[model samples]
Target: MSHLEREIAEQPQVLRTLLRAQAAPVGAIAAAIKRFQPAFVQIAARGTSDNAARYAQYLMGIVLRMPVGLAAPSVHTLYGAQPNLARALVIGISQSGKSVDVLQVISDARAQGALTLSITNDANSPLAQAAEYHIPLHAGEERAVAATKTYTAELAAVALLVTALADDDAMRAALNAVPDALDATLTLCDPIAGWAQRYRYMPQLACIGRGYNYCTAFEINLKVTELCYITGVGFSEADFLHGPIAQISPGFPVLVVAPSGKTLPTLLTFLEKLKARQAEALVIASDEAAFVHAQQQMRIPAATPEWLTPITAVMPGQVFAMQLAAAKGYDLDNPLGLTKVTLTL
Candidate 1:
C-alpha cells in the first residue's frame, strides 16, 4: 500500500484518538471562547484545511447562530490592511501549521483584538504559538502529498469544538459515534475498489452536495484532482441547478454526498433530475432509499443530527479517490509537483 492509502486507512483510529485525548482541551478552548463572546467568526486556511474550515463555517452558523466568514489572507499579507475584528473569533487551520499567510492572518487578527485560535497537528509549530488558543489535531505525521488523516482529524476537531461551545449533549454524542461510523465506511472499500475500475478512464467529474456536506463535496473534488489528476469541480446542489446542470450530458459522471438530513429531500430531487438526463450519479448516502435514482451508491452508517454526517460521509469518497488513483496508475504518495506541506503567502 502507498503512504496515502495507509494514511487514508488510519482515519478511523485517528478520529477516535483525537476525541479521546483532546476533549478536555477542546472544552477549555470553548470556555475561553465563551468568555470572549465574539460576535462573529472568521476562519483562515488553505487547501484541504480550508475545506475543513468550510465545514466549521456551516457548523458555527447553524449551531451557534453566528455569522461566519472565511478570511482572505491576501488582505492582510498583500494589501497590509487590518480590518476591525474586535468582536471576532479568528481561527487558523493548517496541518503543518507553517503557512506564512495563515499565520500572518492570525497575528493580525490578534493584534486587532480578535480572540484567535489555531487547529494544527504540530502543537509547537509557529501558527499554534501565534494563536491565543490551540487545538491539536493529534493525527500524527502525514507523509502523503495528498492529506487523508489530517483532514478527517480536522473535521473531528471542529466537531468537538462546536459541540463544546454549544454544550449540547446530543451533538457530543453524535460526534462520539463518528469513529465507529468511519470504521463501517472502511468496510465499503472492496466494493468501492470494484466500482473504481469503471471510472479509470474518467477525465473529469462533478461532486455535489448542500448545507454541511457541501464541504465534503469540495474535499472529495480536491482529493480526486490532486491524487488522480482529474478535473473535479464541486458545487452546491442549488448552485448546480442555477445553470451548471447544462454541462451534463448522457453518461457523464457526477458524485453526490447525500447523507440523511434536512438537505436529503432536495438532493433526492436533484438525483431524479440527473437520472432524467441519463447522468451517472454515484451517491454517498446513509439512506438506502436515496439511492433509487442513482447509477451507483455507497451507504454509510447513519449518523444522527445530520450536521455531523460530513465527518463520516466523506470517508467513502476518500476511499474511492484513492482506489481510482491506483486504478489509473498514478502515484498516490507523490503527485507530480505537490509537496506534503504547501506554503502560500
Candidate 2:
C-alpha cells in the first residue's frame, strides 16, 4: 500500500488511541478554560488544519455556545497588528507543530494573557510548547504528503475538548462509538474503488454541505484537488443556490455530503433543484429519502451526532478522492509540488 492509503486505513486505530490517552489531559484543559471563562474563542490554522478549525467554529458555537473566530495570521505576522485577545481563548492547530504564523499567533496570545491551547501531533514541537496547554493528536508519523489521518485526528481532538468541557457522560459514551463508526465507514472504500472509475474523466465538480459538515465539503474538495487534480469547488447549500447554481448545466457533476441530520431536509431540496437542472450528483447521505434525488449515493452510519458527523462523513469522500486519483493515473502519496508541512509568515 502507498503511504497515503496506509495512513487512511490507520485513522480508526489512531482515534481509538487518542480517546484512550487524551481524556484526562483534555479534561484538565477544559477545567482551565471553565475557570478562565473567556468571552469568545479564536483559532489559528492553515490548509487542512484550517478546515479543521472551520469545524471548531461550528462545533464550539453550537455545543459550547462560545462564539469562535478564525485568525488571519497576516494581521499578526505581516501587518504587525495586535488585536486585544486578553478575554479570548485562543487555539492553534497543526499536524506538524511547525507553522510559523500559527505558532506566532499562539505565542502572541499567550503574551497577551489569553488562555492558549494547541492541538498538534508533536507534543515537543514549538506550538505545543508555546501554548498554556496541549492536546496531542496521537496520529503517529503520517508520511502521506496529503493528510488523511491527521485531519480526522484534529477533528476528534476538537470534539474531545468539547466533550470534556460539557462533562456529559452520555456524550462521552457516544464518542466512544466513533472508532467503530469509522471502521464501518471505511467499507465505503471498496465501493468507491469501483465507482471512481466512472468519474475518471470528470474535469470539475462542486461539493456541497451545510451546518457542521460545511467543513467536510471544503476538506473533501481539498483532497480531490490534491490527489486527483480535479477543479473542485465547495459551497454551503444556501450559498450555491444564491448565485453559483446558475453555473450548473445538464450533466455537470456535483458531490454532496448530507448525512442524516437537521441539514438533510434542506439538502434534499437543493438536490431536487439540481435534478431539475439535470446535474449529475453523487450524494453521501445516510437517509433513504435522500437517495431519490441523486444519480448515486454513499451511505454513512446513521445517527452520528450532528455535531460529529463531519468526523464520520468525511471518510467516504477521502476514499473517493484516493480512488479517483488512482483512476486518473495521478500520484497519490506525493502530489506534484506539495509537502507534508507548510510554513507561512
Candidate 3:
C-alpha cells in the first residue's frame, strides 16, 4: 500500500486521538474566546488546510452566529496593509504549523489586538509559537504529499473548537460518532475503486455542493487535481447555476456531495437540472432520493447530522482520488513537485 492509502486509513484513529487529547486545551481556549467575545472571526490557511478553514467558516457562522471571513494573506504579505482586527478572533491552520504566510497573518492579527489561535500537528513549530493559543492536531507525522490524515484531523479540530465555543453539549456528543462513521466510510473503497476505473482517463470534472459541504467540494477538487492530475474545479451549487453550468454538456462528469440536510431540496432541484443537461453525475449522498438521478451513487452512513457531515462526507472523495491516481499509473505518495511542508511568504 502507498503511504497515501495508509494515511487515508489512519484518519479514524487520528480523529479519535484529536478528540481525546485536545478536549481540555480546546475548552480552555474556548473560555478565553468567550471572554474576549470577538465580533467576528478570520481564518488564514493554504491548500488543504485552507479547505478545512472553509469548513470552519460555515461551522463558526452557523453555530456561533458570528460573521467569518477567509483572510487574503497577500493583503498582509505583499500590500503591507494592517486592517483593524481589534474585535476579531484570528485562526491560522497548517498541518506542519510552519507556513510562513499563515504565521504572518496570526502575528499581524495579534499585533492588531485580535485573539490569535493556531491548530496544527506540530506544537513547537513557528505557527504554534506565533499564536497566543494553540490546539495540537495530534495527527502524528503525515508524510504523504496528498495529505489524508491531516486534512481530517484539521476538520475534527475545527469541529471541536466550534463546539467548545458554543458550549453545545448536543454537538459535542454528536462528535463521538464521527470516528465510527469514518471507519464505516472505509468500507466504500472497494466499490469506489471499481467505479474510479471508469474515470481513469477523465480529462476534467466538476465537484459541487452547498452550505456545510461546500468546502468538501473544494477539497475533493484539490485531491483530484493534485493526485489524479485531472483538471477538477469545485463550485457552490448557486455559483454553478449562475454561469458555470454553460460549461457542462452531454457526458461531462460532475461529482456532487449532497448529504441529507437543509441543502437537500435545492440540491435535488440542481440534480434534476443536471439530468436535463445530460451531465453524468457521480453522487456521494446519504439520501435514497439522490440515487434516482445520479449515474453512479456512493452512499455514506445515513442520517449524519448536517453540521457534522463535512467530517464524514469527504472520505469517499479522498478514496476516489487515491484510486483514480493509481488507475492512471501516477505516484500516490509523491506527486511530481510537491513536499510535505510548503512554506510561502
Please, what are the lDDT tens digits per residue for candidate 2 over residues 1-345?
888888888999999999999999999999999999999999999999999999999989988999999999999999988899999999999999999999999989999999999999999999999999999999999998999899999999999999999888988988888998899888865677777889999899899999999999999999998899879999999999999999999999999899988898899899899999999989888888888968877878886778888988999888889989998888889899899888789
Candidate with top lDDT is 2
Candidate 3, superposed: residue stretches over 4 Å from native: none
TM-score for candidate 3, please give it: 0.98
The models' CA-based lDDT, in order, is 0.90, 0.92, 0.91
lDDT of 1 by residue, 1-345 (tens): 788888888998998899999999899999999999998999999999999999999999999998999999999998998878878999999999999999999999899899999999999999999999999988989988888899999988998999999999888888898888788888865588877889999888999999999999999999989988889999999999999999999999999999898899999999999999999999999798789988778888874558878877788888898989888988889999998888888
* Cα RMSD for candidates in order: 1.0, 0.9, 0.9
Look at candidate 2 and tell me the lDDT of residue 226: 88
How would you order the candidates by lDDT, starting with the best? 2, 3, 1
**What does candidate 3's lDDT look like per residue over 249-323, in tens digits?**
999999999999899899999999999999999999998998778988887888569998888889999999998
Backbone clash pairs for candidate 1 read none
Worst 10 residues of 3 by lDDT: 186-195
Question: Judged by lDDT relative to the true structure, which candidate is superior, 2 or 3?
Answer: 2
User: TM-score, each model?
Assistant: 0.98, 0.98, 0.98
